[model samples]
Target: MRDLVAPALASLVCLAILIGLGVWQLERKAWKEALIDRIVARSRIDPPAPLPAFDAFDPARDEFERVRVHGRFLNDKETLVHGLAPGDTPGRALQGYYVITPLRLDDGRIVLVNRGFVPTELKEVARRAAGQVEGEATVTGMLRQSEVRAMFVPAPNPQTGEWFNRDVPGIAAAKGLATAGPSGVAPYLIEADQTPNPGGWPKGGQLRVDLPNNHLQYAFTWFGLALCLVGVFTAFALRRLRGETGNGETGENPASATATPPRP
Candidate 1:
């Protein structure tokens, strides 16, 4: 009887801990759902006013916030990022690159803008020669923080104009933009608002807003597993109690059936 006390208590404590974990996952699911809702609401609201000159970009603050910016295209410093796809039909599954060009903001800050996607063949000397943006231009695009690819990938060497990832600071320096100020270029990429462009490569304005909410399914799976474990333990405990009573009734023990000493 004493030995059973130790083992039974230990088993029950372990089950309680597992049930607690399942509850925690449900709480986490609710938190994630609320965050997604906030993002969706913000996306539909009107874009904020253009940021003033010398405003430092906060990667955490302005990540998904939309804002309009007017700038001139510095196409001469453009770099093509390899291994990007377009979402349009004419721009099918063919191999293409993101045309990353620097937009000199009205306040003198240089921002790397993903102008659009272009097929690799379009970058040939002859085709690219005819695709230049002539003179001063007004580019209406979102103010996006730089996108830094954290995983293992080839780095961008802007001198060769051969890039596999979007490294904004490196690209900014390669493009010969001054970065010694407080508002130095951010280390991210911006998807320009769907604006008209010449020489069609990067099909812009295809930014799809999607956030998956499968926490309900995940919560159900965890709770169901916990319930199954609880049912198993309850049956085992009841059967053990019944076995002790049956043994005493058959004269297998000196103790009476109703007052039998608990089995170990």
Candidate 2:
């Protein structure tokens, strides 16, 4: 029994770690489900609402809220964000730039609007000339929070002014909207809806809600691995305990060592 202590302790420690991982994944599953539900519910909202006060905006409450705004597009100041979207034909994907154009609101305050995707070839404004809507316009879209740059995702390229994430503050500063009067620019962005553009180049309605809910599967995997670990440890402990007994797995009696094999 004394000899089994160290191995038993190690086995128990490993078992605890496996179980901890399983529990953590289960927690993640619940969190992911709640997040997905909130976003989906927002998408189904019937009528778009008015924009909130600049200072009143909160990421928690404001995100995914469908909003309507009366504005004029600052076409010349369009910033490109790298994106991929499904093309006219299914399955084949198109690499493009999501045209982040500033919309000067009726009251003079500005907000960044993701007009939609335009392929690399249409990058030159001249190529997709007609899509740029002139004069005042009414736009409806879902409010989106500025994307936080992840650890592994590369930062925007200063040389070419290329931005990958929907970083509202940085884009606003770059476009000189950071101090566009006292109101300046809204911190959040508006992902435009599928209302067609003039030339249909910068396609609208590109909001994608793809939150992968693999946490439940991950929890199952972790729990399954923990069970396997328990089974293996149980077998090891049984073998170790058997070895400690006088009649071990081989069933060779310890007394035979001294009895000299019956003088065969």
Candidate 3:
């Protein structure tokens, strides 16, 4: 009984930790499912709603919501962010850049628009000058939040005009639109629709809403690990009990027998 105390206590602590981790994964699974369902329903809405006022924008509540806005593109201020073409091509991934331009709204305010992908060769604005719209034009697309960079993602290099994420504030600041007073740029960006552009350089409708839902698998894996821990603990306890029983049946105390050794 004394020998089992420390091992049993350690096993119980390990089992509790495993179970806790499993439960946390299950919670994450539920959150991911709800997020998927919400986005799916939002994406299916026909004829996107009008773009909400800048003051009313909410990333969590309005992300993926289809909306339309009438604005003029600031072609000169367009920024290119690194990206890969969507779809599984047999060869290497088609490395490209997403053209993010500022759209000046009718109210004099500005908002960033992800005009979409352009091949690496056509990354220059002059290379696709025809696609640059002049004057006021109505743009329809999905509203997206400012991208949050992962820990592994390198920071944007403003000096070299290179960007890795759709950082609205950073881009606006770089373009000198951060302090545009009442016409300050919005916090979010608009992912342009599939409308064809002149010169066909900055292609639109590149929103990738198909988020992977592997949380359930992860949850199962955690739960399975917890079960394994329980099984191992049970086996160890059983073996210990069996050994003690055998020593008692043979009329030999394990500790006394070991300590006494062979008689001279």
What RMSD, rounded to one decimal, does every model reach? 6.6, 3.2, 4.6
Reference-based TM-score, model 1: 0.75
- Candidate 2 TM-score to native: 0.87
Best by TM-score: 2
Judged by whole-model lDDT over C-alpha atoms, candidate 2 comes out at 0.84
Higher-TM-score candidate among 2 and 3? 2
lDDT of 2 by residue, 1-264 (tens): 686688778878887887888899899989988988898787667788888777678878878988889989999889998889898899988998999999999988998899999999998999998999999988988999889998977799745879998888888887767652348888788999998999997998888878888877887887888889788878767776666443544655767686546665
Cα lDDT tens digits, model 3, 52-142, are 6667777788989988888788888989999987646676667899999899988788988988899898887777889888888888888
Cα displacement (Å) at residue 13, model 2: 2.7
Please give the lDDT score at residue 34 for candidate 3: 90
The global C-alpha lDDT for each of the candidates, from Candidate 1 onward, is 0.65, 0.84, 0.83
lDDT of 1 by residue, 149-217 (tens): 667877666668888866677778877876735466545556666776665545666445566667677
Worst lDDT window (10 residues) for model 3? 244-253
What are the clashing pairs of model 1?
116-202, 117-201, 117-202, 118-201, 118-202, 146-187, 146-188, 146-189, 147-188, 147-189
